[model samples]
Every structure is written in structure tokens, then in C-alpha cells.
Target: MLGPETLSTPPQSPLVPVLPAYIPPDVDMDVVLAEVAADGVSAAPADESGLQRVVADAQQQGIDLKVVVIDTNPPIDTPLRDIATVVAQSHPDATVLVLSPSFAGTHSQVFDRVTLEAGEDLAKTGNPVQSAQNFVDQLNTPDFPWTGLTIVLTVGVLLAAVLTRMLQVRAKSADAPKPQADTASADS
Candidate 1:
């Protein structure tokens, strides 16, 4: 029941549950930024030199990638994505990847939201370096045109149905017997 007056620091939002957006209090923004500024990858959660190597290679390839691996979530129920967003505010132009124990989150200026979400899906290996490797690998994979393939398949099925219907009609008409008119009546 701490009121605003009683709070020594800025109050956290129950809904957003994040810091005031300038910087998140639970996370050491200075350390994250400093590590990223040094070699494009943070030092925590990924002490393995392989993640740093992967990030360095990505940077060399013009990816402008920065990775942050948080060993734990914030003090509140903050999403890893929110942390990534906070990092993004500091560097809007660089792609930031933030990994947690069970989830991945990212924010990027060089990539679209779809790609970022896809990267997050690929980056949930629970190992920071593996997550980063999977994300980078996904970038090189070409997109298959599922929409176009679906359209083609639909049209083919419709065409086949129409051809079958037309052939059935033709066969029925050919098998139909011609009427022998009034000749029998005249003979009678």
C-alpha cells in the first residue's frame, strides 16, 4: 500500500510493468549498452565466445545486430520483448535481440516486425549462442511463395472439376437415344 509519495523511485505500471521507457530500472541499461557498444553483444547470459564471434561476423556482414541475453526476467512480470523495446529506444537503428530463460524478444530498425517475430521464434534454443546462430541462419533462408502456390493449386483443382463435369455432360448426351417419331403410329 505504498502511495506515490512514499515511493522513493518512479512508480512501475501494473499493466505495462516496465520502467518509465527512458530506461528500465530492473536491468542495468548502462552495462547492456556498454557491452553492445563494445562488440555488438552483451556479456551476461552468454559468456561463450562463440556468441560474440557470431555477432561480430553478423556485424561484418552489415547486419548491424546487437544481442542481449538476460539470465532472468525483470523484477516484475516484464516480457523479454519489453526489454528489447527499451534497448531499441536507445538504439533505434540497430537490431536488438534479447533472450530469456524460456523466451526470445527482439526489436529492430533494419528489419520488419514480421522478420523480428520470426527471428524470435527461431531464437528460442535457450542457449544464447545457438539462439543467435539460428536467428542469423534464418536471415539467409529465402521465403517460399506459399500464396502463389496456393493460387495455382486452387485453379488446377477447379479446372479439373470443370473438365470432369463437361465430359460427364457430353457422355450423357451421346448415350441418349434418338426418338423414332410417328412412323410407328402411321404404320398402326
Candidate 2:
């Protein structure tokens, strides 16, 4: 037979293990480009001629080039625009991607207008060179989910402690000595 305290105690569940967070690898331009190309088309042209060559070659290969341009100015330069136009012309499905470091606050407004008109996606890089490198680095790291696991583990620990305490109290009560009652009788 169990006492009221012991009978009312609930069974505790096992502790849930906590998993570590995964940090994603740094971004790699080569790998990124390769992945893009593998799915459809890719190109990295250095100069005007190279850009044209890549555009023409990608067209022949039946792939739409995805241009990634990184600059440090606002509104974009005429030469850059010309190159983008050439690429667009060669591959009608191509997208002119632009990343600029100088497009912040007031400068960004100009970028937005140009990007909208040109049908391009312009992202602010903060610092073109460093940002590019950082992006690549981020791609190279691993990613992990930590917050959810921590919550589960914390709950399990709390429950385990409560159950241990209850068990101890139950055992102590069952082994405790009780007082004996005595009766006195008078002689007749």
C-alpha cells in the first residue's frame, strides 16, 4: 500500500538529448557558379571581349548566362550597362545581377530605379570586395539548429529532478517506525 504523497506522484519521462547548432560553410564563388551552371547556365567574364565571348558561347551551349557584377559606385557605369545589355541580348533569358558597395541611404534610391528599369536585382554589398569574400566564407560553414533542442532538454532535466525527489520521500515514509499504543487495566 502506498501513501497519498507517493500515490499522487507522476512518472517522469527520459531526458531529451540536445543537438548542436550547425554553421553553414563560407560561400564559394566557384562552387556557386558551378551549381548555377550545372542547373542551367553560368559565366564569369573579366572584360568587354570576355563578356561577349562568354555570352556568345553560353548561347551556343543553349544555356542562359547569370551575370554577377560587383561594383563600388551608384547608378552603375555606362560601360557596365553596355556589357549587361550585350549579355541580355545574347541570352534573352539571362538575368543581370548587380552588387554595389556604395548604394546606401540616398544612393540606394538611384540603384533601385536603375535595377527596376533594367530588370535586374541589385544588392547592397557594404564593402564590395570584403562582402564578396565574406559571402563565400559563409557558404563554406555548416548550419545547426540549437534552440529547439535546448528547450526540450531543459524540460526533461526539470522533470527528472522532481521525480527523483518524490521517489526518495516515498521510500522514507514506507520505512519509518510508527508509535505503539498502550492500555492500563485496574485489578478487580
Candidate 3:
């Protein structure tokens, strides 16, 4: 499994840049500002000071910021819960997102309970539209369900082969036992 550091780093820019820095005149600044103002911040703090940066930024903006902390194989004495408590105390409105990639089952349940009680949104993060599209595409793809057209074609070929073999076996078995009578007459 990839460590928290790997997941926390923002994906590097592609080999080719997708967009230029300047915005065209046709684009409305108000709309852009609104989008920017509404945008949420995501972060993974390694320590208390790192966590403070996000809370401070959200407080300054007067908008709720979502904080995500990723920890892999954290120790029992880790300050994750304490950090979360501090964040909630400092920024009551902000939602903190916590993900534990290394732990599953009961460990996740405990985390979920804590996050919910604290009024935070806890889950793995990614593009929702892309995630939905991927699921839809997988369902639509030909190979997912094995009992579709491909299976029917394969079964038809196998049945045809079995019938052909049965016919050949019957024809050989049905041949007369004339040679036995000839041998008996020769012996007589």
C-alpha cells in the first residue's frame, strides 16, 4: 500500500500544461471569484503547526475549510484525535476529513464514529464525476459479467463439439461383429 505521503502530495503537472495562466476577457471575474470563494481547501498535516495553517486560513476567509489528514500505520500515541479536537475547537464550522489507508473494518468504524460525532466529513477524496463515470463505464463494458453474449457463444461451440464427438462414437460402436462369426466358421 502507498504511504500517506504518497496520497497527500498533489498530483504533479502533466508533461504538457493543460491551461495557460491568463484568463480571457469573455470570462466573468465575478463568477470566477464566486467559484474561488466557494472552493474548499484540502490538506494533510504532519504535525500541530501544519494543521494550524489550514485552520488559520479558513478563519481569515470566513468560509468553512475542509481539512483531510492522511496517516499510515500511525502509533497508538499519535496526536491525530487531539489535532482534530483542537481544529474543531478553533474552527467550529470547518469540516475535517480523515482517511486511514492502512486500517480497515473496525478501525475505520471507530474513525467514522469520531468524525461523525465531531461533525466532520470523513472519506477518501477524488473526483466524484470521474468516479461515477468509471463505475458506469465498467458496468457498460463487455467483459464485466461473464454470462453475457461471450459465454453464450462459447457454450454453443462446446455443445456443437460434444454432439459431433457423440455421433462419431455411436457410428464406431454400431459397426457389426461379423468378424466373430467368420472366426468361429473357420475354426469349425
Q: Rank the candidates by lDDT, best first.
A: 1, 2, 3
Off by over 4 Å in 1: 1-25, 45-48, 74-78, 112-114, 185-188
lDDT leader: 1
Q: Choose the strongest candidate by TM-score.
A: 1
- Candidate 2 has an lDDT of 0.41
- At residue 30, what lDDT does model 3 achieve? 49
For model 3, how does the per-residue alpha-carbon lDDT over 151-184 read when each residue is reduced to its tens digit? 8999999999999999999888888454445676
lDDT per residue as tens, model 2, 54-123: 4455446543434444333434333334434433444455544333344321111212343333232222
User: Candidate 1, residues 1-188: lDDT per residue as tens digits?
Assistant: 96667538777766563344433455687888777777777756536488788887887777877788877755432456676776777778888888776678788877878777787789988788888888887765667788999999999999999999999999999999988787978998
lDDT of 1 at 103: 77
Worst 10 residues of 3 by lDDT: 102-111
Comparing 1 with 3 on TM-score, the higher-scoring candidate is 1
Q: What are the Cα lDDT values of the candidates?
A: 0.76, 0.41, 0.39
Cα RMSDs of all predictions? 7.2, 24.3, 19.4
Query: Pairing residues by index, what is the TM-score of model 1?
Result: 0.73
The deviation in Å at residue 54 for candidate 3 is: 19
